[model samples]
Target: MKLYIAEKPSLGRAIAAALPQPQKNQKTHIELANGDVVSWCIGHILAQADPEDYDAELKKWRMENLPIVPEQWQLKPITRTRAQLTVLRKLVKQADEIIHAGDPDREGQLLVDEVIDYFKLSKTKKNNIKRLLISDLNLPAVKRALSSLKANSDFMPLSISALARSRADWLYGINLTRAYTLQGQKTGYHSVLSVGRVQTPLLGLVVRREQEIAAFVSKPYYQVQAHIALTSAEKVAFTAKWQPSENCLPYCDEEGRVLVKALAENVVQRIANQPALVSHIDSTEKQQAAPLPFNLSQLQISAAKQFSMNAKLVLDVCQALYEKHKLITYPRSDCRYLPKEQLKQAKGIINTLANSSLPCNKPAQGADTSLVSKAWNDKQITAHHAIIPTEKSPENSSLNTFEKNIYLLIVRQYLLQFYPAYIYQQTKVHLLIAGGQFLSQAKMEKQLGWQVLFPKSKKAKTVNNSNQKQHESEQEKTLPPLTKGQTLHCQQGELIAKQTSPPQSFTDASLLAAMTGISRYVSDPAIKKVLKETDGLGTDATRAGIIDLLFKRDFLQRQGKAITATEVGVALINALPEMATLPDMTAQWEATLTAISEKKANYLSFMQPLTAIVTEMVQGASQQSFSGLPQVAFKPKRRKKTFTKKVARKTG
Candidate 1:
């Protein structure tokens, strides 16, 4: 009998629907007409055994058993899914052929492959196993994936990489958590000090930001603005900001903000009613293409910003849209570009959207399907393409408020690829007044184009210009026609006093953005490059969970829209080593894992150093004193018991 093993039940049903009909649906397996059976796992049916599973002595948390490295790692069936495993075991033994169907990502590959390994199949049987990779649950997409099956052995490296990551995390997390929890107990803080490869570094980000905010001291700065009136027929007026010359260096701060009130006042007095010459004028027309389609991280950040939704909540909504509603493709995709071959589906998808009652229906109808944006590059495709709407219409999907909002967001982003670029003109005017340099800038929208799709309330006021100085103010205005050497009258100079503001606390949007772009936080160029190449500290599939873990562990707390580290969190970060708290180590591990997946690096080379690092960390932690940490009351968890009722009246 031919057997098909899927990653989950929903996927199993999807695979069965694409196969030959006349199938009998049983509780555990589906039997096809041709003696073929399809079975599935519930996420991971097997997990790495805990430290205590290796030895009884390690059951109790103690510093003496600090580094628990297992010589032969063991896998135990998760209690909740043992029944599913039993059914799979029976099917595996009866099958003559097997097909491994899993999600096309690393974790998905390992989840199914590990189950196959647990069955202890013969070498020939293992070699004969076929792999099915499915990203979209739509029938056409599933059928296409079914026709392109490859040998499961070809992905052994990917499985191996995942295995290494799992084991490494276990070793690092279990050892450090035990060690730190023990040390924290010495300070009367009895709560478990959980440390993870990603979560700890993420918590560190919040703690450090809190520290900076606490230590910040505001300082006053002064600026000089000249209210200038054009001497032309139009009689247009605009505000020009003072640009300090080399002579004003002594009175200016590092950011060119004048520190001395007297200096600013003198400039204001001198420039008052002065004749200003328009020495130079720069006018340039710029076109901005629509942003690429939603990657998971980008989508999460957008949802967090626009709707105040948490990262986990956004991911859940995307999953519902993809799996339940069949309205979107993969939700956990890291790639923001679509495959060129998929471009043919644009017209169908756009038509479906236009016919639907979505808020973006008008934009979809107006979209030029022939105009392909830069988002359709095959070379940039990763494990999965960008998250995009499928050809399926959402008219009868019965989506909730969150689901509909996120679906519309994804559809709008995809439709933007077929819209024209937003065109605008930027004008910069350099002026001279009383031997001082003044600057004025304005931006005029030449064409709304794709920008018209966004509501006026949601539109950004200004575009980011990296070259623009901090003191420069950009306004939306239409400057009167003027040439070089033209004179304008400075009606008056105003002195604006401002205080330097501390960095804003991280909101859900900014926090996710930080995780996605963690390279910007590092100082070392090598580490920065690695982080950028690896796409930051954690994968899109795992980042939300890591952030959620921190909150559950009391390492992070939410203050309205901002996320801050708790007292325990700050103390834990202070107690941990710098390497554990920073993202550099995680970036390096990610690089090594990527190399392992590419077959350029081996498991031993990565694990040996990791084990050594864990050993050193354990040894170092054993000697450290955590007495300075705040005391936390240990709350023991209460386990609920279930009672079975018996018929007492049976004897009567």
Candidate 2:
């Protein structure tokens, strides 16, 4: 019999619907008319065995067993899914042919492959296994995937890469968590001080920001603004900012902020009531394209900023839209670019959106189908394309308020690809007043274009450097027509005193943004380049979960939308080594994983060094003292035990 193994029950049902008719659905497997059967796994049926599984002596946490490296890694069936696994074992033995159906990403590949490995099929049956990759659960998309199947062996490297990642995480997380928790106990802190490859670095980001804010010293700075009246028919008046000359470097701060009030006063005294000559006028038209469609990270950031929704909520809403409602494509996609071939579906999807009762219906109807934005590029496609709306209309779907908001966000971003670029004219006027330089700038919108679809309140606000705040204010004012050599009277010179502000606390939106663009946080150019290439510290699928895990562990706390590290979190970071708290090591590991996926690097080369690093870290942690950490009473919860009485069976 031919067998098809799917990643989940919904996927299994979808696959069955696309097959021949006269299908019989059973609890564990579906039987087709032609002696073919379809089965599935519930996420991952198998999990990595614990350290104690290797040896009984390692059951208790001790510094002597610092780094537990298994010579032969083992897999144990998850208790919750063992029944389904039993059914699969029966089916695998009876099947003459097998098809491996899993999600296209690394985790999905590894989960299904792990089950296949557990069964230990013959070499020929393993070689004969086919692989089915499905990103969209829509009927048409599923049917297309069924027509073309690739050899499962072709994806072995992907499976291996995932295996390497899981093993590395286990080795690193388990060893460090045990080592640190034991050490923390030495100082009367009974909490389980967990450490992870990604979560620790993420917690470090928050803790370091808190430290920086605590250590900040506010200093006063001086600024000079020029109020000038134009010599035109309208007599338009505008504010211009003082531009200090190179000779004033001694009196200025590193960011060019005037530190000496006396020097700023001299400029204010010289420029007042003087005739200012327009030395330079620059006017240039600029066009800004609409932002690319939503990747998981970008979508989370947007939802968090606009609706104050947390990252986990956004991900849950997206999953519902994709799997349950069938209104959108894959939600865990990291790619923001769509395949060129998929662009042909734009008209159908747009029409569906226009006909629906969504908030963006009008804009969807007005979208130009002929105009294709730069988002459609095949070369940029990753494991999956950008999250976009399917041809399915959402009007019939019973969506909740959160689902509707997230769905509309995805649809609007996709529709933006068919809109015109936002056009604006930038005007800059350089004035010379009493031997001092003053500059005025303005931005005039020539065309709103795609910008009209987004409300100004929903737009992301840019935070300017403290030194450039005055200059930014000038750019917001309107400017009149002016030419070189034209003379205008400066009404007055104003000297404003301002104090530098400390960095703002991290909000959900800003924290997710930091994770997505972590390269900006690092100082080393080499590490920054690696991080940029690897797309930061965590995958799009796992970032939300990692952040959520921190909160559940009481390592992070949220105060009205702002996320801050808890005392336990800060103490843990203080106790850990510098390398464990930074993102540089995690970024390098990601690059190596990518190389392994591409078959350019092997698993041993990556694991050996990781093992060595873990060994050194465990050794160092053993010698470290946690006496300085804050003492918090933590009682670990004990699982309730259930006892069942056994009935003796009668011998017949």
Candidate 3:
């Protein structure tokens, strides 16, 4: 019988039931009529041993043997699930072929592969098994995968990547933890010092943001506003403003506050400055096409903004929709489009979902799959298409608020791909001040096009008032039909003072935005250009986890819907080396890993550099530089002698 291993018992049971009427459990393993024997693992049934496991002496803190770099890592049957392992061993031994039917992701791949490698499963030519990967743990996809089973070697690259990532993490995590723990003990610290490659960098991200907030100094600026009566014939009513002189735009005093009084001092400057008059009036019509489909990053961002849901929550909702409800495509996908042949399936999915509780508001009749050209590129899809609803009616109608929003978001965006481009006209009017050195004007907008699709985007999303006003202005304006070159009389005008503000610290959303351009900060234009040509900092699948790592370690905190860093986080990262300071660590890793994925770079090339750098970082952080914070001192210390106690002893 062909052997099938699923990630968990629930999924295994689901797969088994989907097969042709299963025979009663006969022997050691559960057998199915399709000639498939299904078994499962509970997370990790085997893993590498701890440093202390290697030797009894290794358990003690010893700085001399800090870096416990194992020549070849070893694994043992997980103690907690030894009973399940016995069942798995019996099943694999009797099976003719084995199918790695785990969750379709890196962790899943690694976990399943680890089991096969652990027990030395049959590697004979008699075995013709392969991985069965599909978005949801449903019947149709599972049966389809079974009918088309290929050899396991076909997915060697994916298997290799999974192994590498896990091993790399192990190497770094183990050594650093041991090193830091020993270092702490030496400094009279009794607690564990946890260090991880991803965790450290993630903490650094939060810490950097904290520093920006802590050091921020707000500067104020003044504007000269005049209430003016629109001409009688025009019968217009609006406020007017004197163009702040280039020099006096932000008339700052020594303390750097905006000089509101300075504007009053310059009355002559106001009369001479005059109000900004409309010099040019231009109007045109334009349309904004619907946005591209939901890549994981895009989905996370939209969900976060719309429902205050984190990436992990959105991912959880997607998993439920895919696995439990069986009404959505893969959730952890990087691609937002499908291949040409996938159009049929797309139509079917839409039709299927239309009947689901997650029904579409509009008719799905005119969904010309061809019209979604921007989203339809075969080359972009590797593992799965965007997270679209599946053919099955959702069994998850009672989804939480975040889950519902994410599901609705994916559905709306996917449906919009077929919707016709929104049509509208836009208008802009600029007025030139009567007396100013060509620097002041008034402007307005006429029409809103596809902006209607996204009310949030159409409105200014920022908290800043001036920016909000600017967006509101260009979005819509009622201008009395004034032709170009119409000189308007200004009854009143005044000069205003303004000052430039320092850039604001990046928010989590903005941080993700910045990470999209890791190459932007590079000094060498050539390198920067190459980074531009490359993908964003981390893949859609990894960035969310990266941010999660930051939050888990107390580095990042959610303070009233805003992400900020803790003091310990700041101190820890501030002590890091220059290389660790750069967020491009994620990008660089991805670039090299992508090359490895493409076979352009050797595995050693990527591994050696990271290994060397991490070694150096561990050594560097070992030194003490903390202040007003808790840190494990990485060195032994002499016992302190209290002066008061010593004096009492001497007197006695």
Model 2 deviation from the true structure expressed as Cα RMSD, one decimal place: 5.4
Off by more than 4 A, model 2: 232-236, 456-476, 632-652
lDDT of 1 at 40: 92
| TM-score for candidate 1 | 0.94
Off by over 4 Å in 3: 23-30, 53-57, 121-129, 144-151, 184-190, 222-233, 237-284, 353-359, 363-370, 435-469, 479-486, 494-552, 631-652
- Give lDDT: candidate 3, residue 205: 57
What is the Cα-based TM-score of model 3? 0.80
Per-model TM-score on C-alpha atoms: 0.94, 0.94, 0.80
Residue 206 shift from truth in candidate 2, angstroms: 0.5
TM-score of 2: 0.94
Across residues 83-163, which tens digit of lDDT does each residue of candidate 1 receive? 999999999999998999987778888888888899899999989999887888889889988999999888888889888
Q: Tens-digit lDDT track for model 3 on 1-652?
A: 7777888775676677667784556333467777778788987787665555567666554656655655666777767788888888877777777888776665566678888888875567224657777665567656665676666666555566655555566656656555654554554554444455455655665566566667777654555544333453443345444444556546655543346665544543454324445676666655556666787777887777667777766777777776666656777776777666556667776666555554453435435555655677888775567766656655445677666677778877777777666544444555554453222223332333223345555443322234777546544444456666765545454545555554555555655655555675566665677677565665666677667766765667777677777765665556445555564564566666656654567667777787776677677766744343465443332211121111111100
* Model 2: colliding residue pairs: none
List ranges where model 1 is wrong by over 4 Å. 232-236, 461-475, 634-652
Q: Model 2, range 136-211, lDDT digits (tens) per residue? A: 7889888888998989998998899889888888888888877887888888987677788888999999999999
Give the alpha-carbon lDDT of every model. Answer: 0.84, 0.84, 0.60
